[model samples]
Every structure is written in structure tokens, then in C-alpha cells.
Target: MSYVLNDPAAFADESTDGFVAAHRSLVRRVPGGVARTTAVPEGHVAVVIGGGSGHYPAFGGLVGAGLADAAVLGNVFASPSAQQIYTVAKAVATEAGVLLSYGNYAGDVLNFDQAEQRLIAEGIPTRTVRVTDDIYSASSDERQKRRGIAGDLAVFRAAAWAAEQGLDLDAVAAVAARANERTRSMGVAFSGCTLPGATEPLFTVPEGQMAVGMGIHGEPGIGVQPLPTAKQLGELFVEALLAELPDGVTSVDGARLAVILNGLGSVKAEELFVIYATVSTELERAGATIVDPEVGEYATSFEMAGVSLTLLWLDDELESAWTAPAYAPAYRKGAVATGDTELLTDDDAAAETETIAAAATPEAAEAGRTARDVIVAIRDMIDREADELGRLDSIAGDGDHGIGMKRGTVAAARAAEAAADAGAGAGTVLALAGDAWADKAGGTSGALWGLALRAAGDVIGDTEAPSAHTVAEAVEAARAGIQNFGKAVVGDKTLVDSLVPFSDGLTARANEGAALAVAWAGAADDATRAAAATADLLPRMGRARPHMEKSLGTPDPGAISLALAMHAAASVLNHTTAQKEES
Candidate 1:
């Protein structure tokens, strides 16, 4: 559906580069994303906002004087890596601190929390406030479980305003949290979005029907209804938001609200204004005062025919913060004063070249080469199966799983091959591969895989070749890392569904004194069976939870991909065994 792209995998990066080029005066290139070109005062808290790339003006386009000081850009519909977030935060951080803000999504939460910990460990004060404003995502009582939508604008603006006022990190974080709590949003989609190079959209609504409560990441809506006129849609938006006011607000009457009528891509400004026309009238009829109503694209899905409405119940402080001046590529509010600017000298620090160490012995070097071969097999397998995996994911998620897996495995394979050529040990090879996978993939699966690989590598050290027992132990370590990091159990219908069985099978075979190849083959079989079993279960975690019923007949994409990787690794080990037997 994305017609004007060379390689789908490179679209996010290429688009970011072009964006930076176009907004050179307002923003400059940073490691993970973009930062303001203007100067900031010393001891002022820096407000850093980020999410996936599909939402224009939300992340990159909001980097300027009164919005975000920096924005971390992730792959399309994928959260950025923790390393990327840390790099971007460090690039914009001042003596006071840094406040990392983003939408409330699983991947974003995991990576941002990791980055927050790393920043604090290095003595940089860092805080995070996740925006949860989509009223339809969850029941009002379960507000914390709600997803963030177009309400990101209000939260980001409030936080940035507090920062611009020279507030410390804690104060800025409080403002962002307050903004999130006060904001409520709901959306509807007439159609779904397609990923680049994909022949079909992720999901589609029937003609003359619309999906209500759809997500920005190509997730299908919770419910469907016949499409209505612009006026009827506006009434729907106003009625839904007013049904439940934030805790502080007692009544909708006399309530001052900051309204955002956001077009979720393909719904142009004129169409939005037509909807806003009715939305404003409805709000006024409800006896609520609208303040600075925004009618345009703020947070968007790639070419999704949808619109979301956000209402921020403003108190005195929130109103003042909301009215503050801002200047950005996609958003400009009032007059913003300028100052002398200087380019970041440490921008190139993120580009430091990696050097692989020589193995301690020839056996370790040979093991590293074997690891590289295994990674290459995994990469090839993913390339072959990506489309099917993505199809499964599209049933309940953003449908980027296959592409994400391919990106990770390809990057991992390259890193593994380079490490093996440098005579690195198996441990170093796997660890470097994991880092590359995470850095390039940038999603929930990417983070988990990278962590699992690194954990396994840590157990297998760089000193010597691994025995069957050592390999089993390493696999167990990997399984443990995934469970601990992702917090998913077997029935959760995640990759852990397959990984746990595979790990247990490997440990059992190794304990029975089986050879590495035989043990791995048996474990791979277990993983394949476990992956297939997931088709009978409903997803209880991650992005698929909201659409659990839709995924009932399909296996989790993560589980399938893990099983495929396990089988690929087994094939490599079997080939090595065969070669040894021949010799």
C-alpha cells in the first residue's frame, strides 16, 4: 500500500532521514531520533517523547521550542530499542534531568523503563509518564490498562510546557501524569491500514460500516456499526467522552476542555473540520467550553481512514500549560523566542564501531563459526516464513511481526558472521548478534529475543567450547530471561509457549546424556508442537489481548517464529553432526 518506497524494511529510516533534512532549522539528527536545533538553558529538564514512526507530528514533528526537546523514532509500528531511547535521552539531557514520555503500550513501556533504569544508574535523573487516555480500550475502572491515542498531544504539551517553565524532572513528570489523567479519547475507523509491500490491509471493515475503538497501530476495532453522518459521529464523540468525566471534574456543565479532532491519516484537514463543526456544536450544547480545539492530524496511522477525538478537562494549571507557546515542524502555537544554537558534538558517539575479540582457543573459534551458521539458518528460515507470520499477527495485531522478525534475524546473522570471522568465541558471537537484533528490530519481540540471546551467551562464556550440558544450561538461561523480562507464562500465548517446552526438553535430553544435535532436535520438535498448540488458545497478553477472540484459530506469531528459529538451529547442529560422522 506504501507505493513510493524502495525497500519496505528501510522505509522508517529513510523517512526519518528525509524529515530531518526538511526540518534542518528546527531539528537535527540524533542517534535514535531527532532533537531540537535550538539551545536549552542549563539545569532545565528536557522533555523527550517518542513512539513508533507511523504517527506523524506525534513524535519527530513535535521536537521544537515548547514541545519535546528530543523524540526517539522507532521502526514503523514498533517501539524503539532501549539503547536507542537511552541514546536520545542522553543527547538532550541537561544538568537538571530528563523526562521520558510516550503512549501506554507494552513495547514502549518495556524499552522506556529499561532506558530509565540505565539513565538513573549512570546518575542522570530520569522519570517516565505513560499516557493512557483511550476511553474505549478498557473500562473506566481499569483506566491504567487503557491505550494511549491522540491524547498524546495534550500530555506531551503539558510536560514540555512544564519543562519550558524550568521545572525539575519530578515536577515535569507530575504535569505529564496529570495531563494523562485528565485526557480522554475515543476513535473509529472506516478502513484499515496496509504495511509497505503488503498486498492487503491489516484488517478491513465492511462497506457502510465502521469500526469503533480502533488502535493507531492497525489494530481492528472492538466493535462495528453502520457508518453515520459527520454530525452523528460528532455527537457520538461528545456523548462518549462526557459519559465519564475525570475524577476531579464533577459535571460537564461549565467544564473547560481542550479538544482534539485528530484525523488518523487519509482523513484530510477539510474532512476533519467538517466533523469538528458538529463536534464543537455538540460540546457547546453539552454546556462545556472548548478551548483551542485542534482539527488536524496529530497522531496518525499510516493511511488509515479513521478519526479520533480527545478531550482534556483543564484545571487552572493544566489550562495555563496547555496555552503555552510552542514551535515545531507540524505544530506551532503562538510566538516562540529564539536563541543561539549549537550542534551536538557527541552525536557520533552512538556510531562507534564494534570490535570482536579473538577467541581464547581454536575450539571456541570453531564454536563461534557454528553459532554463525546457526544464526544464518535462522535468518533464512525467517525470510521464508515472514509473510505467513505477518498474516497471523495481522489477525489480532499490527501485522508487522514477520517483517520485524526478518529484520532482527538478518541483522543478527550479519553480526554473528562478522564476529566469527574475527575469531570471537561463541559467547561473543551470540551476544553481538543479540545486540544487533535488538538495535535493528526495535519491538517487544526484538527486546525479548535480544535479552534471551544475551542471557544464554552470558551463561556460555567466551573461554571454551560448550558441552551438551552447557548448551542445555544456556538454553534454559535464555528461556528464563524471556520469562523474567516479558512476564509471560506458557498459557499467555506468547513465544514463551514454545520456548518453555523447548528449554525443558533440551534440559531433559542433556540430562539423559544425549548428544547436542540429538538433544536440540528433540527440543525443536517440542517447540514446534507447542507453537501449533497455541492455535487452540486465546492470547492473554500483549497487543493481541484486546482482540483475543480473533486470534483463537491462529498461533501467536512470536511462538511460530521462535519454533521456526529452533528448527533452523537444529538443522545447523544436525549438519555439523553429519559432517563429523563422515570425517
Candidate 2:
């Protein structure tokens, strides 16, 4: 039940703009997300954190002196693109190596891992520590598979504190890793969450019943039962969290703990306080001493009627780190020493770009013009089908794919136009567009699109127009790049399904001496068939994995989107050749 929104598609971007506008003192706008307005000190590890946009303060709200240096935001319930992650890391990195941290989710793992590699390749050292503390997501034997929940605060705070204390990158990562092992969280939902334009929530709970062991991404809980009283709910949380004591503690006696009772969106503060009161009493009964107990929102789903409890078992070092001062937009502790608060903006770059000019050969310049038209067609198609794409995603995954694709394609279209106008080559235009797509659409789809576009561009050298063989090779490379980078196989019910078929069809047709335009059209037909066939396959990766049954009758949004884009691109290629004939 989101009450305020202009266009549902623009909700995430508009909200991010508003967040920075209201908190200029603490965080300033950056390409990926927000950075602390105060200068990032050199000779210290930079802690960068991120995830989907709906979690708010969990990511961006935690950017400050004693927390994250920057937060990379993505679309609602999606992970930030690899380019966004890399750009933010580059912006904030100092002499010391950078540390990238986020919750354990498929998209986050894919994007962050790629960013880490890119940073390392650029000779800027980087490390990563994924937060995994949700006790319900997996068994103790499969701890690495667990998802992170409100417990992310404990890990991020500890790691950021270590960085502030001048710890090296490995030491900082170790601190976060230890914190993750000692922390455990569990949540229950009284009702499901509805996206901005949706008429109903992602899932529903019957009146007087509640869902237990739920995830934050509009996913239903593992079990359902009648609602309990506040004290009973407290007992449930404690019992669930304590059942798996994280391998270190055999008993709760004399153990120091940091307890957090989090409200997931629609839950009220007063109600939370009532629950925490009983929660504290229960902890005392278990002989666990509560230290710095926090009771408020930290991580959240969009207006989900839910609550989560987190416990961080603390040793002496963890205690000191936990008590260290912090001042972020959402969370705060003791006062922080103020430093330079200067901000960077586009105005700072305008002067630097004044002398730049695009470089291209005559044939390549014509190819660049055609690339511009193709990008425009892609953007228009996305805008036209944005709502439908989102609806399809909502059937199993979070309903943000359409808007994310629309944002990426629109940004790509604009960048391609600018590059063509400046006399850039086809490869340069595609490269610029790819960067924009990743920057604007921070998600798994965005990252994959970036990989596809960049790989294709690499084959289309700037000196000449690409031949039919070159075009076929570009398609094969794009498909291979996506498959390798995303680690999704053909039967995973992802875009890889259509992408592989399209690439094969193009290469086969091209080898038989067909024209580039005709080969691409035939390939597009192959993609359409493959995408439609995905309706029968169960999802093996990404957010849709949890709701496999819901997706059985519907085509994967990613696969369908890729097919549609290829169809549009085929039209563009044919139109270009037809115009050349007429002229």
C-alpha cells in the first residue's frame, strides 16, 4: 500500500533524489548512490555497502564517518549493477584498499563479485564480506546459503568501525565475517507488501493468521499460523533465534549480547516497543546480558507488516567496536568530529569535458548513426511494455524489472545519441550506451546488459563497419559473456535461454552467406520461440527461485525482455539497409 507515487516506474529514482536532497549534510549524490559529504580519509579502508532501494537506511542511510563510505542502490528488491558498484568504489577509494559488503542474495553476489574483479583488474585492491545471518533461510550445515536480514546492521557497523580504527582491508573483512557468524535473525509477517501500482500485495495472509520465517523481498513465510500476543511473539523470536546458536556458544549463561527488534515498514514504534519489552525480559531469563539494545527500523521491505529480531553475541573486541560512535542519516550513536563537508556535482565535471571530441572513420560514423537508431528503438519498446514486464516479474519475482529495463534503455538511448552527435564510432557509441544502461538500471538485468553490450562493442572495432561475420561473432560473444558472468544455464528460466538460441541462429545463418539483416531477423525469431518455451521451465536462479510454482505458467520476464529487444533490433537493422538501398 504505497500511497504516494507519480509514475510507479519512477518511484525508486525520485525517492533516491529526495533522500539526498533532505540529507545534504550527511550524504551527497554520487553516480551509483550517496557518499558522505565529509571527505573520505586516505590511509583507511573504505567500507562500501549496497542492495535494492526499498531497504533505505540499511544501505544509504548508513553512509557516514563511522559507517559506509558509499552505498550503491538498485531498483526495489534488486541488486545494484556491477558498473554502479565499481563506479562508487572508485569514487571513494583512497590509498587503502576498499571493502564491498552486502546481504547474501543471488543478484548481489553476481554483481558485487564482478565489481570486485573489475576493481582488482584496475589495480585498486578490494575485498568483500557478505552478510549471512538469517537463521531460517538454511540449515547450519548450509550456513553460507542463508540470507541476511536485520542482522546486516551488526556486521556492517562492526566492519565500518574496524575500518575507522585504521584496520587493513583483510582485518576489516575478518571483523565483519566474525560479526556475521555470531549474529542471527528471524522475521514474521502479519501481511504481504504491495508494490506502488499493484492492486494487491505480493502475498496475503488470512485474517488473524501470520506468516513465519519470511524474507524481506515480498516473499511469503515458510509457515503460517494464528497471530499470537506480544509476549508470545517475543517468545517465538527468542526460541527461533536461539535454537541455532551459531556454533560458538553451548549455553547463554553470562554471554553478552546486542539485541535489535526491527519493525519492517508498516509496524508502529509503540507496537515494537511493546514487543521489545517482553523480548528483553526473555533474554534476561536466558541469562544473556543485553548491551546496547536497539529497537527500531533498520532493514525493511516496502510497507510490509512484519517484525524481525536480531541478536549479536559479543566478545570483548566486539563490545568495544559495537559501542564506538556512529553518525549516519538513519542510525546514530555518540557525536562525531566534523570535517570538510564539500560536495561534488556535475558542475565540477562540465569544465573538464569542454575540450573533448568524438573520433571515428567515415564508414564507422555511419554505423554509429545506425546504432543510435537501434538504441532509440530499444528504449521506445521498453517504455511501451514497462508495465507489462513489471507485472510478469511480480508473478514470481519482485515487480521492478519493467521499470529497471525502461530506465536502463532510456539512458542508453540518450548516451548513444550524444555519442553519435559527437562523431563517435559504432563501438564507442555502444560502449557509452552500455555504461549508461548499467548506471541507470542498477540490477541483475542491468549488469547482464552491460556485459552483453560491451562484449559486442569489443568485436565492432572503430576503424570500419562490421561485416556479417563480425556481427555474428559479436552476438556469440554477447551470449557467452552473459552466460559466464551471470552463471545461469539455459534451463535456469533466465535471459540466457533466449540469448543462447539467438546467438546460435545468427551464427548459423551468417555462415551460410545470408545478409546481416536477414540473419538477425531469423535469430530474433529463434529468441522469441525460446523465450515462450521458458514458461514450462522452473526457475533455478535469482529471486524467482523461491516462488517457482507461481512462475510455471508465465514466461520469465528476463527471457521475454531479451527476445523483445532482439526483435526490435532486427527491425532497426532491416530499416537501415532499406534506407541505404533507397538513397
All models: lDDT?
0.90, 0.86
lDDT string for model 1 (1-583, tens) is: 6879988889999999999889888888888888887656788999899998889977999998889999999999999988899989988788899999998888888788889999999999999999999988889999988889999999999999999888888888998999999999999999999887788999999999999999999999999999999989999999999998998899888999999999998988888989999999989988999998888999998899999999999999899988888899999999988656565532543655777899999988989999999999999999999999999999998898998889999999999999999999899999999988988888898888888888888888788999999999999999988888778999999999999999999999999999999999999999999999999999878888888899998999999999999999999999998998999
RMSD of each: 1.3, 2.8
Instruction: Report model 1's TM-score to 2 decimal places.
Output: 0.98
- Model 2: per-residue Cα lDDT over 247-358, one tens digit each: 6788888889999899999999999999998999988999999999999999988899999999999988788878888999999998877755556552221211222146
- Whole-model lDDT, model 2: 0.86
Question: Who wins the lDDT comparison?
Answer: 1
Error of 1 at 311 (Å): 0.6
TM-score between candidate 2 and the true structure: 0.91
Query: How many steric overlaps does candidate 2 have?
Result: 0
Measured with C-alpha atoms, the lDDT of residue 141 in candidate 2 is: 88
